[model samples]
Target: MDDLASFLRNRRARVVPAEVGIATDTRRRVEGLRREEVAHLSGVSVDYYVRLEQGRATQPSEQVLDALARVLGLDATEREHLDRLARRPRRRTKPPAGKVRPELQRMLDLVAGAPAMIMNHRTDVLAGNNLAALLFGRPLPELNTARHLFLEEDERGLYADWDTCTLDVVGHLRLSAGKYPDDPRLASLIGELAMGSDRFRRLWARADVCARTHGPKRYRHPLVGRLDLHQETFAVPGESGLELVVLSAAPGTPAEDGLRLLAGFAAG
Candidate 1:
């Protein structure tokens, strides 16, 4: 499970002193908003806010989240992130039918230059080639990526920026759940993660939502020291539970060399 305290600490650290208009006094001990200050700004009791920051509050309402977002000066993206952390419930419905079409798999394979993988709303690795396996570790065809990250021990070592990746994974899941509220598979995945990983539970409760689009990713490959790549997701036309992700690096950088080495490893 992810450490909620750690997540909160990271979020708290990202807000600069200037960003919040809090002049840093010479005697200030804490870097960001004091617990009492945050509580006052959010209109909640200091004790309650402290507990929430400590990851003790099991659930927080939308109003509280909105207040917290306002006080924290969260952007639209960050406010949505806070909501995801506040609103994830415990009970779960069945998961949606999470299967990739054969034609989609063929199409994924046809993207030979860029490493690609097919994933469902639940982040299940449905299909991919040897290159994908090498890049993302062996495909967890039966497991959701969130589960692998939070429940599996290997994930911490696998993802270079685990916290950022966690945000992406959870945000994508939130978006999918919002888009398909009745999707049984997605619901089940959320429930399973919540039950199995306290960190996932904390994040889900915040109610963050994001569409997985294009982004830069840095990976510390087990075999290749470090590589930075760009990830792009393409929606599959007419397919409900599948999307294709492609990873690419700039043509002449060290990242390209690492990717080429990775491809060669896959080829062998």
Candidate 2:
């Protein structure tokens, strides 16, 4: 099955009996909502929903998808994800190689106070400012973050909370992979990581998916020690493959001071 179908199945399995007002009966054969139950809640016919889950149906109407989202109790991100899946044209086309446009590079350079980097859907660091290099410890010229996390030995040392960070990376990648299953680049990256890193293989097998657009991130900088920062990712308009990520620290904090110091060091 494709990623979307598998994801829906997994999510269905996760909503427990108590959460949806279902009884905890040991006699129940299935782990989650029955196909009929989901169809009922989604205002769709059981056969139609089953066809959707089986990857036989495509192009579900927005109203039906919204109903499904409501039935699934999806958050804002999850709802958008479902819509994307429903609206996705039937094609196995690969994503074009993601590149940072000159204007985006200029924008990154212009942001002097905050460290910024442009990353593709595959989490490849296409470009970054000097401050970003300083903060992330001078990322290798052609390194992809997903590859570095799974294959590079130094990744654990760089990310203080290695386990949590690694899981998050893997989960996020899995989500992206699901969204763009036909992308050869993403497939190759996942295949290589699965073969090389047992940890990545295990995580991928779990089928966990996540979308972290904005959040607090803690990093152990080689030069600045532990630094707590907020991270936000902005999609570059008119650019399908590029995303700009900016990191900032709270004002009047040690992290802010460290960031300033690091920026100065980068300049020097």
Candidate 3:
């Protein structure tokens, strides 16, 4: 099935009818709102909704999208994804070259006592500082973070909560797929993960969407034991699809001391 159609169907299967004030009964065969029910609630005709799910209606009006989004109870990120999926896709463009600018590399090196790295939409680690290399226990070049989490046995053990981390990463990739529908590399990466990992396949089918901007992440490092750090992501100016991620711990915390130790190790 097409991405747009599959996305709508997946989301439709998740909304609870009672949560939206529609009474539920055992007679209901589907798990979530039925297609006709969605049409009625969203102020659209059943034929149009069905056409949408079949991927026949490509250009939905803003009013229609807004109504569907409300009925589906889509979050801000999901709403944006819905809009993207509804619009006509442009011609396929070449994926980003995944090159880290010399200035950006210098910036990564200058970030003190923290692990910093640059990544693209596909989680390709374009570049990383010495501390980052120590933190991940692997060289950053040619490392796809998503692949590491799902496919590598040793790397999977680093996350204190691996399942949640993998889910969030999958959601981020889903959002990227919506934006860059024709990116062959991104498509290949998704296919590879799906074929290699059952967990990835399950999460990918959920149609979840997310953006990893800032959050606290816990890691179980061989050297540090447990390190809790907050991640900050910045989009590189003038560079499309590139983000700078820096992981730092709060002041005076044990995590901070662990970072200091890691920094020393990097220095050594």
Best by lDDT: 3
Off by over 4 Å in 1: 1-97, 153-156
Per-model TM values vs. the true structure: 0.63, 0.84, 0.95
Residue-by-residue lDDT tens digits, candidate 2, 113-198: 78889887788888988888887676634768778767774444666667776788887787676578677778888889888988
- State in Å the error of residue 180, model 2: 3.3
- Please state every model's RMSD to the true fold in angstroms: 6.8, 2.9, 1.7
Per-residue lDDT of candidate 3, residues 1-268 (tens digit): 1277888899999999999888978887888999999999999999999999998887889999999999999999999888888883644435566788899999889989989999999999999999999988988995888998999843348888787789889999998898788888889999999999999899998989999799988899899878999999998888878899999999999999999998888878
- Greater lDDT among 2 and 3 belongs to 3
Question: In terms of TM-score, how similar is model 2 to the real structure?
Answer: 0.84
Query: Model 2 misses residue 243 by how many Å?
Result: 1.4
Clashes of each: 18, 0, 0
Q: How many residue pairs in model 2 have overlapping backbones?
A: 0
Runs with alpha carbons beyond 4 Å of true place in candidate 2: 90-97, 153-156, 206-208
Which lDDT values do the candidates have, in the order given? 0.72, 0.76, 0.88
